[model samples]
Target: MVDNPKESAGRCAQVAGWLTAACQAGHTLLSEPEAKAVLQAYGIPIVETRIALTEDEAVQQAEQLGSPVVLKLLSPTITHKSRMGGVRLVLRTAEEVRQAYRAVAEAAERQAGAGQMQGVTVQPMVTLEGYKLIVGSFCDPQFGPVLLFGSGGRLVEVRRDTALALPPLTTTLARRLLERTRIFTALQHGAAGLPAVDLAALERLLVRFSLLIVEQPLIRECDINPVLAAGDHLLALDARIVLHSIDVPEIALPRLAIRPYPSHYLEN
Candidate 1:
């Protein structure tokens, strides 16, 4: 069975401790910035994003990241951005970047009551084709780390097609997980005019993410939605991370170093 009773009990205790602490601190959950920091510390290949406190800073970041950038309002209260127009995409100029920043800020303020928002996140816009994958991790009552993969984004709820796998995943297992998903057929047939995806990279990423969850118990959940697969390159276009309640004793989180995939292993 995928669920282990003993391990699940321990995980539940850990989660309870975290929730108690959150109540004491008056904080609901880990904010995006906090969650992303934890993810970056791990070996996740996230886009280059910088938090900007001012319009000048946003412009500077746009220049640094180059044109056709993305600007978003960083807020803990706002989760679904598309609903509130909190996300701006394909900003090609400094002026456009500034305008997006203002738009996001205003919308966040109106929708969320008090803004309490960080400036903005200036990120490079990545073009994707093959498939948009949503990979996630959740600590289940019976299973320790339940890893999920599916067709991501707005269609996720619409399609409700996904696959689940247990941790310590191998490349072979990852491929099997993908095959179980309905989206895999389309991805293999060049539905978006892109070549077959680099399944090796996808497997590596999922394994790495699973390891991250095992090492960091404080990470309640993580979502790398729309992991774009274009030919041989896989890019994480958007992400959301949630931390467990605070007040749980701070345990040492293991760190994974980023390294290039072994070439010889591919031959086998």
Candidate 2:
């Protein structure tokens, strides 16, 4: 179904306003929930998440999300959550959820003292039966916004398999970008008994992502990592967005690295 123009515009405005407020507050990073919300507003599929202010609330949220939920610490001062042991995944029972909750809360209290950390966020478990992909964008001093697609997850740095392209992308352009990567071949022809990815769906995601970076210039860096590619769909399991205020007029911003896509290209 086609999206209502007014509704779509409203969502965009809300996201823009939130980003502006965050930047004005001198915040460099968006909390995970906030980042996921921004991605959701832009038609990106994300794992639904909710905050729990208390241990009982955490269990309730997890129960509502169903069994095997993941709980992540909600702390502004803590960036390396995994290192700090703030992430607890695959809790299959209410009792497990309670234990995990205390662990993360205690972790936060130790690191930032009392009341420094907000409660935890509960998200449903995502399927592990897919390739882990990364979609990202960053503002280059000379090239303005540049897009990235590659092998993601914890090994992203070690693997270093990636491709770069200038945004505004159409399906064909996105396909070409994918073709430039080594994983594209594996994605087309499944490896190690895994099924082939839903390439069209992934390409559409890339197109929407390109438009996000192109239109939302305030987003200095956006990372959607470990995008699960499976079941004839693509879902972003996690996302992070960093914003910066534009110092100059739109026209005075750095030029594109390559020729721009046609005006009609955006219509499709």
Candidate 3:
């Protein structure tokens, strides 16, 4: 859950400072864990992941996350994971996770090139009976911050069921944005015998995500793909944030079209 707006603002400021340091150090993308941390701070539900340096460590992490886990090769150089065959899903046992760890690591090294391989990450498999959605935000050269929603998954590129809105969205506006998308139509009317998806929960998630962008101006782009929606639950399966290397002036309000996160309340 999210804290009070003031506290949330403080946390976002803290995260932005850390990311700015990374940007200064020549990092453009936040690693999975770092992205999840930002999302967690904003009260988004994300898949828990742990870095495993070895096969034994991978098995241990899988055990810790519980059975039916997933293994992915974590690397700075490997941007498109599925294309490189760097992802393994549905490892139900420790041995299976161990084997998957080695395979994914080796493949990542081969595909991503030497010295580009980081350790593998262990994540619990998320099984949902509802739609997979995408939620994201980006800085437009002309429009400042823009929020996006759509159908998402392995074939998201092909489907292209997306809608866009400006940041600092109200609940009503966010709902309208969702309603504009084709997936939202399916979600509203029910799909494949599944009951109508939880629009209220999804709306709340989108609103929070918008506020997160308003709070953190350094974020150039963010992707929360396959936001699993089943019944009244929504979970972020995979996420990433891209940072820009521009210096931000310390002002009361950021230079955004929308009202940025209110940091003034933090003093009180």
Of the candidates shown, which would achieve the greatest TM-score relative to the real structure?
3
Residue-wise C-alpha lDDT for candidate 1, range 1-268, written one tens digit per residue: 1224455445456544654565467565555454454455545577777788888999998998898898878776677777788889999988899899899889988888775676777788875555778998776765555779989876888889899887656667777888899988776766656677766777777766665566555666778887887767776667776665555455532222323243244431
Q: How far is candidate 3 from the true structure (C-alpha RMSD, Å)?
A: 3.2
| lDDT ranking from best candidate downward | 2, 3, 1
- Local distance difference test values of all predictions, in order: 0.71, 0.82, 0.81
Candidate 3 per-residue lDDT, tens place, 1-268, comes to 2457667658878888878887888787877878888898888998888888778888888888898998877787665677888889999998898788778877877776677777887898987687888998887777887889999988889998999998888778889999898887788889888778888888889888988888787788899987888888888888888887645544522356766445454443
CA displacement after TM-score superposition, residue 52 of candidate 1 (Å): 0.7
- Give me the runs in candidate 1 sitting further than 4 Å from their true place: 1-37, 248-268
- For model 3, the stretches where C-alpha displacement exceeds 4 angstroms are 1-5, 246-255, 260-268
RMSD of 2: 3.0
Residues 8-37 of candidate 2: C-alpha lDDT, one tens digit per residue: 568778877887788778776788889898
TM-score of 3: 0.90
Q: In model 1, what is the error at residue 33, expressed in angstroms?
A: 5.3
Clashes (N, CA, C under 3 Å) per candidate? 0, 0, 0
RMSD of each: 8.4, 3.0, 3.2
